[model samples]
Target: MVTGVEMRQIDRYTIEEIGLTEELLMENAGQAFVNHIISLLDKKKARIAVLIGVGNNGGDGFVISRSLLEKGYHVDVWLVPPVSKVKGTARYHMDIYLKLGYQVNSFETISATGLSQIFMSYTHIIDALLGTGYNGPLRSPYREIIEEVNRSHGNILSVDIPSGLSADGNVDEPILAVKATHTITFQCPKLSSFLFPFREYLGELTIVDIGIPKRAIDQISSERFIWTEEDIIQTLPVRKPSSHKGSHGKGLIIAGSQAMTGAPILTAKACHRLGAGLVTLATPETAHQAIASQLIEATFHLCPSENGEIATLNLSNEVLDNRYDAIAVGPGLGRSTKGDFIDTLLTSFNKPLIIDADGLYYLKNFLPSLQMRKGVTVLTPHVGEFAYLMNEPIEKIEKNRFQFSKQFAEKYGVYLVLKGPYTIVTTPRGKQFINTTGNASLAKGGSGDVLTGMVLALIMQQRDVQSAISNAVFLHGKAADYLTRNGWSPISVIASDLVTIMPHVLEQYQYS
Candidate 1:
């Protein structure tokens, strides 16, 4: 959750306020890095290369190189800077490494041809050339060295972060970055690992507890965070042994025009799979038979429509009298003329309302009343819909997603689930929960409908809006992650495929 600046602040506080020695932390990092390397690759006479910088990152490298040599493994230490440039604890470690007769080559003195030759001799390479402090364009030998490292056929292990990656995820575009096979970070997860372009550089992220006191981390007031498995597991709804279907939750879905009937079908099915006790489909009369055929378990309500689409978004009095636990509107409802109908429904519906797809399109006209609305409103908007709602350019919104999403959620008094990589889930009070699960697989159509249904189902079961919605987002992504982990290509997967496999994923969380 911490930015690069915040991470530096925490590090300083750990060393100064907590009185933890920097030398000890550096040793811990190198030792842990070496330990992980031994576990990952066979160490019986294995060869490894440690690429070092002039700073503490290189200090960690020197310790690692010496440790590997002591363990009887052939170790090659390549320092990018001259030996004179190495200062403090890094110089201290380099001195010991030289005294032990380990060769430390100056990367500045090597040619591109020499780098390629040296790189080929090692099967494993430790990228300790740069840590979180790296940003902007590559300079001098670091550039050519990284090129050779990438070109070489060796498994890469990055220390803290890949050499060219920024800890803040500030790259305007993807550039030359070390494509690490695994990155072992210290203390907590960094911002770069969770962000889009930078995330690609981090292959398999491993956060090691480098003994930074929890009190030091607590000083960081960064409210943003990526939800973990424990956070999701703790928020999952517990089913009681004695509870009946009626006690689980009741949900009503107002979606699916005759032409776009797949949206409501996906949403309703997702709701049932997500543990909705009772679900009723309130689609256009013309779309009822098709939706009903695929959804036999759900009851149906054929609402008034003209030309296979709903004429208005108003709810019928009979449906309102039934008092459903939750209601989600606007997934594939097609185009509809909005007047006072949305206002009437928002006031009268009087339950948890999840607006997605076409609903987001409709809600764009009523942004003023969103703050004054009586019921809880959850808006699941993609970049385009959110841009329409805010009347901002797509480019501008994407660049400042966190800031824009937080403002909209707080100003409108609604829970905004802006769907994207590490989807930002922000509450009206400015609590941000970044979802880390899922991938590009969920980018297909009908995915939002499934997520909307999951949120609606959870809201019906749980009273805490943040907990319900956050868990829904996490579970929705977990389903996609589950599919991808099982060899289903993200590109080949469909929304229905997510719904089909989601129950099995949910089953894993049952007894947790």
Candidate 2:
């Protein structure tokens, strides 16, 4: 996935370097979009409204309208701007469309009632009013047009991206963006398509090649990546026939307080469910009895407690030893006064360390320690926790999820998993892999805890740290998706339900 800016650069490189003309590229993009959406269109009954702006996006719409008319489909090309404003390649295509004996409807003087009547009358509305480069608040007729477009029940297909939505994934006024039933983007998927709130606006997204040179795409180092099913399939860990229980890996989970003991149980169970050969739980001795009964597979290291929360970790003992392959901390371990527990784990643990929940809360105090760590540190934080760590408001973090995540990951030399709708996993080197396997069903209190355990288990098992982290995240969401698809309601699927159904989800890839 490339950012909007990166996509524009590629467009320039394709035209100048590869010698593909702007008109030819627009023609190809239009054809590709038509081919993708043709099945959904009925030549006899489909009344199409191709909304056109005075940009390259409108140029593509002109081609799409001409192509649709040629195919015997009834189409009306509406110019959102005046005829005098349309220039360059967009105007060039408009001339051809008009020469084909097709009429263009100009929205220059159309009233609100007239606009709604036109939009509501159409069976499918193609949003070509704005392109990926368009950002910030919508202005004048565009804003007014979009508000009516949302009210229309017509199946909307946005070209490149929904009008008014920022391709950079920033939402200043998201409510003004067009609500498309489908978005056929050119070259590659835009970054905004994967983000929340905006994802709702862009429905059933498709990426069309538009004949852009592979070299042009390669010229820009698109740090953003998405892991497909094939990637997960190939990366799935294979257990050897002669392998014993120890062959998989051992994981240590330090979580839980007397008040919130279920977090550790959920974490340990998820760790074991994801195929951790040996699982150990380190928590307050007071909480052990509660966590132990629920998660029997894990061995316990009862830590000293102060008022139900773990006060400190006895690092001198074997609890933080070499026998464990990974350690996951901070699911339910509440606020600690000293903050040394997190510091000790960061410094003492030479192996991979996964921190989540309250662990992230404490780690906020030791942000600099992440850079100094000799071992790999993985931080899994939702927007709220991430905001806490960054000491910024949630609004700022939500708007610039990519920028903030990339900065933190690169600066600290740690793998960062910023969890939400489409979970983004970033490496220390600044490469980000956006996960698309899950749905809203995964939204729950313990979902993040389940993810922490999965990350802990997978990192120990998979040789490549990147694959391990991405796979765990993908699978964690996939499990929730599976449950919701079968019979479970989104609200009914709890954290433990995710752990329960994970085997069935993993088995598909494992045995396939």
Candidate 3:
């Protein structure tokens, strides 16, 4: 079930399918908008300017102006086109404002000096000029007004999306979008707001409750998702006091070579910290000492190798029969070990698997076997790794991350976590969860390895595939967010730091 906040995206359908008039939706949207502004400003003496266009967006501006006037605030309404050109709900609202002894002016009639005088007088600028319907490039008077607003230096607020930004995706050479201090977007956040490049245009976003019916949203299907803390808390695995270490589950991590033993060590440590009862690391025989010395909590399995890399080994029934909750491979595990150890593991293991880095590289070579696995599998691939697995160019993956992530999950019938600025979690069931925590400090090396460990740990703790992936991704990023706030640099936030902070981060969800 979605929260009432998520249902606001259905307002459009409520107007069209459910027989509710657009005018009523508009009034509710406008009143909600006014309420948010009042909560921010709260009786502070300030002059407000409302910049509106000709469509329903302008209609919302008109309603806001009427509501503000009723509240006894000094307000000026500037319509892009003449008042006569306004139509539908916009025209109706304009008529109401005119009858209420309020003045509405056209941009054309105001001279350059007059526009400057108007711009300098307002403390808060309301940009009701564009809504989600905007497509392609911005044009003419709207473009000029957007440029003026960009230069105004006044605090600006956008209605749905910042004007000039594409509602569906990023636009090349986008005209100056409104630099909103805060954006009161109706319903769901647009796809563009989650992507890079254009995400900067949307300021601190606030989704206002506009009374859109829930049935309308349930009828629609979308792969995009936004995850909240409650969502994570609900999915957490229940732990019993009677449970022992073996009952919780055992996870085997095959990672780290000679020069990169730290990667696997980080992954194993994170898994143990996240409550994986028994954690083991399979590494090149030469690196066993380093991993064993550092991570006393995890057992080490020495694997045969040449030059600090593990060679492909035959998987005996003895190895496969041993109970393991899950298996994770490929963080700093070199590509040239033997004739595909990753392929050997995939064909042999029938347990839950978490694949990252070199493991993802090996999977790219044998993607057909991805569907053949008899057990649950989660693939955590960064953009480049994802590109290799999908056989698509990196540029193409970056441009359409949401589509590619969803496609890969459905194609392989496994959970996929496409890690980046906003990590996207896609499940075989077609549900998508977008994680919003984490900052630039997570851009350092070994961070991905830490994330891999956390996911495997959750799986060992008996969390479902979706819950394991979602909660792990959220906490992994949130750990970095906490460290970043404490002034930890990207370079200084090593893998061990993430493990140290896990308990504090997990505590935040206990009450939920």
lDDT of 2 by residue, 1-512 (tens): 88888999998998898898998999999999999999999888999999999789989899999999999999998998888898999999999988878999889879999999989899999999999888778888998899999999999999989998888776665367898999999988988888767788898998888898889988984788888889999998988889988988888888999999899998988888888899988999988888888877888888899889898776563546657888999999988556587888787778999999999888878877778998989999999999988889998898889889999998899999999988899999999999998877777789998999999989989889999999999999899889888988987888889998887998899988
User: Model 1, range 1-512, lDDT digits (tens) per residue?
Assistant: 66778888888898999999888888888888778778876767467888999788889899889888898887788788888899998888888889988897777667788889999988889999987777779988788888898998888989888888888777777578899999988777877787666787888988887788888888964677777788777888888889999987888888888898889989999998888999988888888888888888888877778779876644675667475877888898886555345555676776778888888787777777777877788999998899999999987777667788989988988899999888989988887888988888998998999999889888888868888899999989988999999999999989998889987888888766
All candidates' TM-scores? 0.92, 0.96, 0.94
Model 1: lDDT to the true structure: 0.83
Candidate 2 ranges beyond 4 A from true positions: 317-319
**Pairs clashing in candidate 3?**
none
The lDDT values for all models are 0.83, 0.88, 0.81
lDDT of 3 by residue, 194-231 (tens): 77776787888888877776577666636566877887
Arrange candidates, best TM-score first: 2, 3, 1
> After TM-score superposition, what is the CA distance of residue 295 in candidate 1 from its true location, in Å?
2.0
Clashing pairs in 1: 330-359
Clashing pairs in 2: none
Better of 2 and 3 by TM-score: 2
Candidate 3 deviant stretches above 4 angstroms: 1-9, 42-44, 111-117, 313-318, 487-492
Worst window of 10 by summed lDDT in candidate 3: 1-10
In model 2, what is the error at residue 85, expressed in angstroms? 3.2
